[model samples]
Target: MRQVIPLGTVTMTYPGPVREQPLAIELHNTLYAADGEPLDGLADERGLRAWLGAVRGRLPAQARGADPRRLADVRRLRDAVREVLHAATEQRPPRPSAVRAVNDASRRCPSSPQLGAARGGGMRAAIDHHGADATDIALGAFAVDAIDLVTGARRGALGRCGAPGCVLMFLRDHPRRAWCSPACGNRARQARHYRRTHP
Candidate 1:
């Protein structure tokens, strides 16, 4: 027989989108969370590799044979991206170090667009890269997206989930949308209802 796990008892896996947002934003959200509970997705090299494997197309290659130092670097980059996003959401200037971190990562693995011949004799658009490894390529993509997110017009759409104890950020795709996901929305509404009925 299968054993059932009780709610709030199991250590949940990553709890956010995989490809819904830019890869950089997704990386920033790897902090699995609930009110007063935050779980780090990149807790170790194994965990980082697992996440990278799950999001196959996001990275040019798998982060195989990652060591503790490499995993720490990835986490550091993620924190920098999160800092930039937070500043953008608040309409404040991003920290100079955060900007530098993203720029540095982007420089490590720059992707250039090129026109290559297709199988049927037509030219197709493709991205060419420099001497970048899997981590560099992935971090470079995130850096590019984070730059756009902070400087582009869509910066106004940056939002943090209003649900109590939940710390997720997202782009507000439409008006009247508040929480990062439907589950968070329901939780917020239920909390409000409970407060009203109890009072």
Candidate 2:
């Protein structure tokens, strides 16, 4: 028997666990939407600052000067990541320009490996970055993660939400997982039901 469910109000902002996503993927998803009524999370300096604050220790340091140019750069990187993810989902190579963008950002603020002694006498591999500002470090980290995601085996799990007018992407860990979130799944089902009944 098919269970009937009610559709709740759709919020203007994305409601998902940000921490659960890889930092680069999270950055790519910063823009809450992609269709006609998209929501920009980093629309201004204040928004950028808020996003940086939320990421906190995951990034190198607090951004010193919040400006439009910085926000633009971040948005550019995010777009490049999106491009790469989109290509990966389509099983095709990403654009050379997009690859270059991610590579350039990563090179500008490369992360160094640090060997540290563990509590019981083992060695631990830690990441140490140099000579880059907070924003650059953040971009580099995102680029590195993006490269890993698009190039690694997990790339096969990449999927875009099937819900109508939705442009969200996600890693499909389960065989039956088609939507990016439960809400999107519900919305898709509701749409299917409406079309069936109306037709």
Candidate 3:
């Protein structure tokens, strides 16, 4: 049987001082890619927790305080993100509930880096014109980006871990961040070994 270690301490990364800030589109896609993973039931919820941990690591500034209400928002956004990603992959339109959640989170969580950038003057209009298809996941990304922007790390270091079958999040503090932990890295290596031997 394969071993699955408990996820360990994850390091967060942010960008350095930048002459040009990360573009809104860049932030949107980056966060979406980091948070979206094809998984089993409630994968979205699991992925959302992983994404939030990344946000906590890259926080530009501490939230004024923990608002328990935000936990509810996270749950809401998690569901919306799942619906949106599934719809996009299936080539369907985002449901009204998903759209509303996106809009609400984007508007309410300006602290998120992705949403803050997407809120750039012309961005909302573009989303409106597109009927909110692609922008569904962008809402949660925006909130996370806002948090990233507040942290000094917004400049260059942001990214997702490259580990396969492990939808963990991490900052690019080092050149290599393909896994959230050495354990995941090892698991991936072992899985590759089995594949090579069996196949």
The estimated TM-scores of all candidates read 0.83, 0.81, 0.37
Error of 3 at 55 (Å): 5.7
What lDDT tens digits, residue by residue, belong to model 2 across residues 1-199?
1112222342132232253567776786676654446777677765565565555546654333323358888888988998998898888888999999999988988667889999899989878877777678778888988989888988777778898866777787897789878877998899999999999
CA-lDDT, candidates in order: 0.73, 0.72, 0.42
lDDT of 3: 0.42
**By the lDDT metric, which is better: model 1 or model 3?**
1
Model 3: residues with Cα > 4 Å off, grouped in runs: 1-62, 82-96, 109-165, 169-182
lDDT by residue for model 1 over 98-139, one digit each (tens)?
Answer: 889999988988677889899989989977766777677777
Q: Model 3 over residues 9-120: C-alpha lDDT tens digits?
A: 6432332111122322122322322223543221343443333333332223333122322444555665665455445434567687876775676664333223233444
Using TM-score as the measure, the top candidate is: 1
Task: Report the backbone clash tally of model 3.
Answer: 19
Ranking by TM-score: 1, 2, 3
What is the lDDT, from 0 to 100, of the residue 162 in candidate 2? 91
Least well predicted 10-residue stretch by lDDT in candidate 3: 16-25
